[model samples]
Target chain A: MTTSIHTLDTPVAVVDVARMNRNIQRMQQRADSLGVRLRPHVKTTKCAQVVEAQIQAGAQGVTVSTLKEAQAFFTQGVTDILYAVAMAPNKLAHALDLRRAGCALIIVTDSVAGARAIVEFGRAHDERFEVFIEIDSDHHRSGVRSDDPLLGDIAKMIHEGGAVLKGVMTHAGESYKLNTLEALQEIAELERSECVKAAEAIRAAGIPCPEVSVGSTPTALSAVHLEGVTELRAGVYVFFDLVMHNVGVCALDDLALSVLTTVIGHQPDKGWIITDSGWMAMSRDRGTQAQQCDFGYGLVCDSNGTLIDGLLLRSANQEHGVASFEEGMSVDVEKLYPIGTQLRVLPNHACATGAQYPAYEALQPNGEMAHWSRVNGW
Target chain B: MTTSIHTLDTPVAVVDVARMNRNIQRMQQRADSLGVRLRPHVKTTKCAQVVEAQIQAGAQGVTVSTLKEAQAFFTQGVTDILYAVAMAPNKLAHALDLRRAGCALIIVTDSVAGARAIVEFGRAHDERFEVFIEIDSDHHRSGVRSDDPLLGDIAKMIHEGGAVLKGVMTHAGESYKLNTLEALQEIAELERSECVKAAEAIRAAGIPCPEVSVGSTPTALSAVHLEGVTELRAGVYVFFDLVMHNVGVCALDDLALSVLTTVIGHQPDKGWIITDSGWMAMSRDRGTQAQQCDFGYGLVCDSNGTLIDGLLLRSANQEHGVASFEEGMSVDVEKLYPIGTQLRVLPNHACATGAQYPAYEALQPNGEMAHWSRVNGW
Candidate 1:
């Protein structure tokens, strides 16, 4: 007997399982065609079942943004984990603990101070830590410029200071801002070439640097070739969102994650239908606002996961969302959607929206349902 | 013996217990002077310890935004609970269950359909649910206007249909948009008079209205008197944030919640000091963006909680924050905040930031520390 999603609580996270599996298979196929290993970033879902599904689809290892994610996935028996964010000195002991627990945990460093701290911690703990030097291809966030002299210095520090210099990795996060395939491909190539150059720079310094990693959801889907990159990493493609759709990467129906909310009341004068899901359920992610179309918190959908064009969740309080037409008055809102009317909202960013819920109610193609719990706080 | 906050994991929520207690006492005292019961909204910090502290400081009851919060706090012995959001029909069973369990759970409704659902559900289940008629004082979100004809109909529907019409409640949520004391006072008065007017209308319809409730953090602290209001409700005051600071309701030092983060690297060329606390940690609130002084994501502070002027967390990725001066170049960025330099970030909105964490590392003024866990998902 399959449980029905209609009977579950409102303001709950709902994942279309068949769509999620299709997304997983597509990313794996893309990586395979590009001649690179796929290391899916688990930060988006952080669910063991989702990660297992990716692994089953031929994804090797995993990328995490937090030590807690690393620890959680490691406890679930997926040993190959890469802590992708630049390593902080304070987290060295936690990394050491994970490494000692027989997990192949690889850490990243980008600055001289970071490399020194990792090396010092490794020496003090009598452990050789595997390290990757983060490369700045897009100048989006953390990382060292590929051609900067500090690149060689940081690489040498990790190599000479009793740590294994695994290689270089870069994420073209700025690719999310681009809507055209040409721009995405350009950023993807820059990401690949810059990261490969950094690896070569370290090799020229007499250190055997293996592995070149590069990707972001946009770049991964748009890259013409992987070339020197040994592996590709991407998050959010596991459950596409409105931002991805606006960026021209995914179709609207491909959005696998949505918040299932129930209309609680209405303001006929204002043409507003209030829903139980607000910023607390949808998350305060306005990622699509900068795109061509601004879906004010999210795009509204009918109860059966079909898009209801022209309506948007225009505003939100902690527990109340106001849904209305994008342009004019939504006449007959009360009669159209009365109290207890269930609706779905596609998020602007899956990673942010998925973080709000403790577990997602996965709806299978055959109408079966399953609960998938995710990692919460660090 | 006490543990230093520095020893805790990076990106952990830190609550100043002394400041929180003072905030609680101040609100309770204000309610006492106003001749009203204080029903502190527990949505900002869903921690039982914080609620217990508020109750000890003379708060009469607690207000929650979600039923899960109601359930969690009810399990902790909080009997008089108000689920503040407008009631959805699908949740009637859960509300009935809570009422049957000897808990004084008060639900809210603002429309005829909402009232009809509650009345029908109560009659079907052989339960007489206590309910509040929600009044829209500021047109901020959900509620019926005091002069709206629907207000009387909704109240009559609940009272005449085998359910208890407890009273009327309203929230002056737009008070947060005002920075001047005069405007805040004006909104506060409007909140009180409108809610009381709605209650009087209900009484005119032969229903015995016993209570009138109103408040918001800015309005609660700025109101000279809350006449005709039986209780005041305000969230985000217990752990005042940057938005409240800009709203002129709380001093910066009165902010009790902060995210403790560590400098992982730096972009010296861009004068960016990278920290581990990103949007995922501090939340994508940006509540102060439209305020007088826009704190990008948040205001930067020293590890000891001293505000570092001119610096703001300008941008954030999923797991990396870029902190820099608001205007000119921040020379010696690496020297000023080297790798591993711990810093605290005051959040833009306490309710949003607190929702991102599972537990808070509460620090006592006497150097003692405790872990306070909070409710996460609905």
Candidate 2:
């Protein structure tokens, strides 16, 4: 049966295949121009098809937030996988299993304790693991400061423990907060200079620091250059969200993922259109709340992906989304969007929202929808 | 091999089986004393094991927020299912299919448009689906007002269309905002009073409205009496959380669900012990942000589930959680919680946090962990 967005079940994740392809090509081309290998983060989609597309578009490898992603992608034939999150000592056995299974899995760490654990585990397993020294470019999350003297100590531990200090990496996650082009450009520059500086210092200590990787969706797209950086890692770019749009990286039309919902009822006096795509489908990620343009849950669009005038999901419960006018327009909401009307809501975050769905209904340009399984959880 | 919390992977969901049983028993007893049937909303845990415990503890049936929940639970041998969300017309076919499959699935609706669609579908399919009219008790979310004329009109449509107008149901969701016992009790009464009023109006309009359902975790626990209410539905009570704690219903110790995470690294100077449980695991609920006490992400507890004084998950990224002191104490983070230390974090909202995990590691009283699969998606 031919299925349009309206024909699909409510609260289903829909991916615009054409827009996704365009996003992939844009990111890949930018990486190519900057003379760096794009190891696209698979955390956003966590789908085999999306990662496959990225690799086909010239991505050198895959960056994963969880070991599950690395295992899932590696099992799907993508050998070079970087486990980007700071490794816990307890997870060493699992990481070793993946490495021993012939997956080129690169583990990252910032603290001396973290490095020692990785080194100790590598020695115990009789395996030489490639380790990346995490750098704090934005101080937004975990990482060692680029110029911190402890970097030498950590580098020495990795090397002495029979492991390779492969490189230095940092994610300019705070770049999502920047709306102005100048601010984004500055953050991008800082991301590059700091990460490269971290790598140079590690090499100066006589430790071989081969790669310097840096990226976040905003920083990667906004960075005019990627000097001295060997690899770039950016997720969410494959499916730009309202957060990215508010950050001035992508336009509303560039959003490739949305939650397909059906209007069940309405609050006539309140001008509200109640939808099945609540926080469970749209996610509780209010990533756009603090941005220049706050999309309450998401920006409402017709089933065809056309932006509906002034409508937005004002609030959400577990399984009910209250869509109303952004400006509190007193127009009859039920008359405008009657019961059973299918609407596609552009989520505030592709990563958070996409995590809520079991699979994505990838809509092709030919008006066909394909189910792409998206792996979730740790 | 037998599993304990210590042996499990980091960032896993854990359910304290003992505490859950206690919670289930308490709610079932409350319903018994109040002269109502306890229909536990399986939407909270979405685990057959958890639902089984509730049923074993004397729950009448199951209340679900999604049709998928009805279908899954029905397959699990739960015949009586109440799909509580306002039904969209397109979902009528799916609901009918489930009904024909020998599942006593009751669909709820509020508007005339919703009632008419259900009627037309019922007449066409030759299936008389049981319908519940949603009542707006506290004006929190979806429901027809108790005094509204449309309630009678919708009731007329359901009865005349050859479908049974089963009853009226309302969720005092706003009761979660109340910290005072008096406020909670009043809201509970209002929920019961308003729902009863709607039921009476329906009966007066020549329709037999047999059931009167009303509940919220807080209201269900605090209501002095559920007078004129035949049934109660509460989900999160099965696995209480910080939001429930702040509402004065469940104590902090009653939070059965917690995210089992391992400390991966530390930002010593900043007094931060980073864990693998971030927004992806803890979820971006922040439900406690406006509450009396804000437990950022969650309340941190030791591996044994003992509350760690002053420690809380301060902020979270996609894959990392920065656990710091609630009072911003300049304590030695590394010494307090070294790398690889497993901690169980009590979530702000149980429903939101539990949705992130694929399964729960149910902690038995004898200190063993059992893997309980949790179904997700609509």
Candidate 3:
């Protein structure tokens, strides 16, 4: 844990420790002031060390994207966990195992058929599976419409089928596409209200709905207030990336994650300084492509983590990234960025880029480093 | 190895063993009939088992995109390794260790500065390292132009620096952009002839040019003859993807890898069948976006490996994928693909998609599975 950051290998994922702590504190304060518990989504890092820090910073429970994550965190002694993604019937046994092992794991469903499968599996196993209904707040991705008659119907089905009907949840993923503050705030309000409305319907139908959750990094940061929401869940806010920067949620300096790379070669005439951080290192997520500013692959930075204006990682092959300036081949690249020079690239999306590496080199404020392992796959 | 593939976890990567071996033999026969050695690029799979199979099928040596691959394969007794990407000066120590361990690790360079660094390091270590001068035949990526005056300059520098000058190499990455057989064949010839021309220039300057290596999956498959070339190196052909299919080189059935997933839920009105194979499992590789036919994230298929006529994985979140018809949501998704139903999705790019999984489930001909571990990161 005491290795120097600069001594690490190129293409290593580095997390700025100071920035990460600040991000965690900012979100925890926001949730506390809004009177909602922050159930930070552990899917962002999937590292026990990072989640431990979140829990220490006042996160009540954890939100997971898969059963594997729930199992992983539960092994780390985290009891309360919510698997955010809609449950697949085939994964029922894995969920049951975690619950039986003393982990309060909650699964979700968005359709009547999905609920039926869960109920059938729960009854067959003679286990009371806690379930949540997913609501469509912005019509961005998979979720049931808040007003759908099936929302209450699925709740009643779960209650009558010997399973625990927990609550309703939704993610305002479409809020990412909006640039204006007003639009983001409106979507945030919608995400909170719709999820609350879904919970109310279930309770009115004589079903016990104990929780109502809503989040997305953008919506969580822009929400005016969570009047009826009981808990907030947001991933990627702990390590804000270029996508969040473009959305006006975080400043460029607030980006905690970057890929440390080495300048290998250069195409002088073409003004390209090829680095070892390519798509494999930075990931193939072009999240900033549709924003007001499009960082081709990512924004380029100096070895000291200072943003280099005009210079950008324009294109990438599997193991090579081409760094070029917007003004064209104006400088002597070989002279300016000689071979072996170290550089860091700010990624477009933190979650995608972090998944590319097995372990993260967390650069502490004292210049020391901690190697934190990251889990991958389902 | 005797376990049935159907019993494996959902979202696991499955490599059809029969199809992979057929791909290996097809490429090997092509290279042998053309009077060239086949040096399979292990970067495609990064699996020792897959590379061993290639060598068993007559591949002479291995091509790698990173020193990590060289180290991994070398530890497995594969001494002949080519670190194909332009070597970064900082990796000199690691390369030296590989060489000292009796590995014939060949490094590459495209510029005078890059050559100088290699020479300086070689002399410092008192080792006559073998070096390859990369030639830019297609102007697509890193290399000194085939006709650039620097070709002879770097070659002379490498030869005089107490190092072994191995000769020239190039990758026709632009070949993937072509769709017609004629265009692909023409680019393949150009890739070969231009690389040969670069080697001729080095030799014309009184330097020995023993090898002329050129390849890319599309170029290697389309080249009519490699008259002046000694070796061909191609990755991704062992597991053809939608990108290669759109490039008109591989048939749909030629694809050897797929993500096996289960239908989790559905939005009956939107006709969306949600699956656990999201970007995390399928990878965020939209490589076919600009191709002749765009397959969103991937093409949908039945559990038995037959292509679904109109179904396509239209979009992906972190832990979920939305499958719908290309024309429109015309079918009752809940009935057609009920919850817990198994499905397969062919990826857009084999290399990117394969990088997402921790291990690949090799599906043998008899429907049994062999879990093959895949190497990741530098």
Candidate 4:
């Protein structure tokens, strides 16, 4: 007999397949409507089945955060992979290995020194690498400024040093802080424009810059247009979380990932329902903490995926999540959620939560469950 | 030619073997002097090699937060195991399986309902399972109050139903908030006396309560005496982190764990030296945020493991960490920390950071490295 989600062990990662498919379709349609290639970042799920589904639903290529991800995806027959993070000289050999093994692996750099290292490594190995110069959009994190002269110099370093200057890419990660569509649209425009400007500067400097990629979950869903962008990339949309919910990108029902936990005990005087799933299962990502509605840990839901009103996973230890009622709703917690009672918790950030588990219990609409293995660690 | 710490891939967990050995010896000596058995919680570093060292250093039994840890340690010949987390009835079968395999797996429960389920499951399986009654020493997390009448009833339920009533246990997890020796000792004594009171209550009810266990990293180190406590348990002391440092327990040099990362790029305008280790590598555990000094994500250290004064990992994305000067200290960003420069980051919480990697590169005193595989996922 096949095991259902209810039969699986507690503190396990569960993926609602129906909701996941709907989310996948929504983002694919959004990217299609915006007229750009959708290269979903596999760093979010890192699951072969999920990536295969995205590819089947029209994701052009995959974006990875590590060489391990690139190697894993490449081994799974995915040839087009972009190692999104700036290439450290130490990892050049590993990236070269993936490329030599017939994978179209692209590397990224935002500094002249980084570009020089990639070029020197490629020259030493007799391999010309496809490289992308990262542009700093909204000053969120890594990347060269769009108007900075370093951008053209880095682009030239790659092209002139016998490496392919593939394009310019930037993630509007700051968009995660916005709660309104107007703000998200404004940042999305900024991300697209800045990245495109960098690409144009590279071209003006006699380097061939083909692609302009930009996205983040909120921006990918809220952007009015993608004028100069060639590809849209987003990760958390596949498993929309409470952070995305508070960001006005998706509703609570759109969340596909939840930690399946069992109520192991209770703290009656404090109105706490202690759960088996804690930071170890849901992750320590308080991504929703600074958002409009801070979900302390996560939003509580019933075993069948129904939201439990006023219930929240307030605090967590390593293996124990202390869930309690929000402020004044004082019901007999033990009578309501007793020992052995199974509950589901919607995570604040899907990518972080997913990384905690080795596999996902994909709950199908027909009550069947499939085990989907995820690639964790660097 | 042996592999050195510098040769390991970026964003890898590195364990200073010498520091770890010193930590192990210190905790073992503390337990010895306090006249209590040391049951070091293997949840901090779930590596068999680390656990082996702890056992060799005089730790009697292992304390685990998950049944997976028990199974793993048991497979490695550690039969004396205490599954410290409150027992969930759904996991009774797994516990039974371990017992049937000749493993002395001790389980815990804090409620009558939980006791009844454990006894019933044991009766059905023809096994008298050893159990410990969890006591709420400081209103920290899960447990029955020490003076609560329900405690005796739960202990009596297990004894009357033909299950082995092992003893009483408590963890003064709130001790983590204490920075002064007096505060730590007070909480530690409170933990000891309260857990002993619960054991006395159980015995007063005619149930042979044998064991009295209590601990926390801070309490374990600061307790002048463990008076009525038979055994002590602590986890993070094995690989002390920034939170423990801020709590005034371990010195900066006592930190046995650090995430070895490479400087990938830089945001010179913001004086941010970007590294490959982010929340994904160091974990989103801002455990030190509420402590004496908030070490943003972690304290920055040089490649040789010496603290770099005033430099901190200020913010983190999924795969990128922004390391910047704390306040007044300023240096030429590009000139000081160039691309490809390796840096070691001390995590805010060792348990959380250690969980991010599947294996650790143990840095030997002789400048060699050994791979220690960690068991992750429940």
Off by over 4 Å in 2: none
Q: lDDT for model 3, on a 0 to 1 scale? A: 0.91
Query: Which docking class does model 2 fall in?
Result: high
Chain B structural similarity as TM-score, candidate 4? 0.99
Whichever of 2 and 4 has more DockQ, that candidate is 4
Tell me the lDDT of candidate 2.
Answer: 0.91
Candidate no. 4 TM-score: 0.99
DockQ of 4: 0.89
* Fraction of true interface contacts that also occur in model 1: 0.87
Candidate 3 local lDDT, residue B183: 99
> Candidate 1 at A290: error in angstroms?
1.2
lDDT of 4 by residue, A1-378 (tens): 269778899899999989999999999999999999999998989999999999999999999988888888899999999899999999998988889999999999999999999999999999999999999999889999989988878988899999999999999888988998888889988998898898888888877899998989888988888998899999999999999999999999999999999999998888999999889998999998898899999999999999999999999999999999988887899999999999999999999999998999999878789999988877
Give the lowest summed-lDDT range of ten residues in model 4 chain A. A1-10
Q: Model 4 clash pairs?
A: none
Error of 3 at B141 (Å): 0.9
Backbone clashes per model, in order? 0, 0, 0, 0
How high a TM-score does candidate 1 get? 0.99
lDDT of 2 by residue, A48-105 (tens): 9999999899999899989988889989999999999988888888899999899999
Candidate 4 residue runs with Cα over 4 Å from true position: none
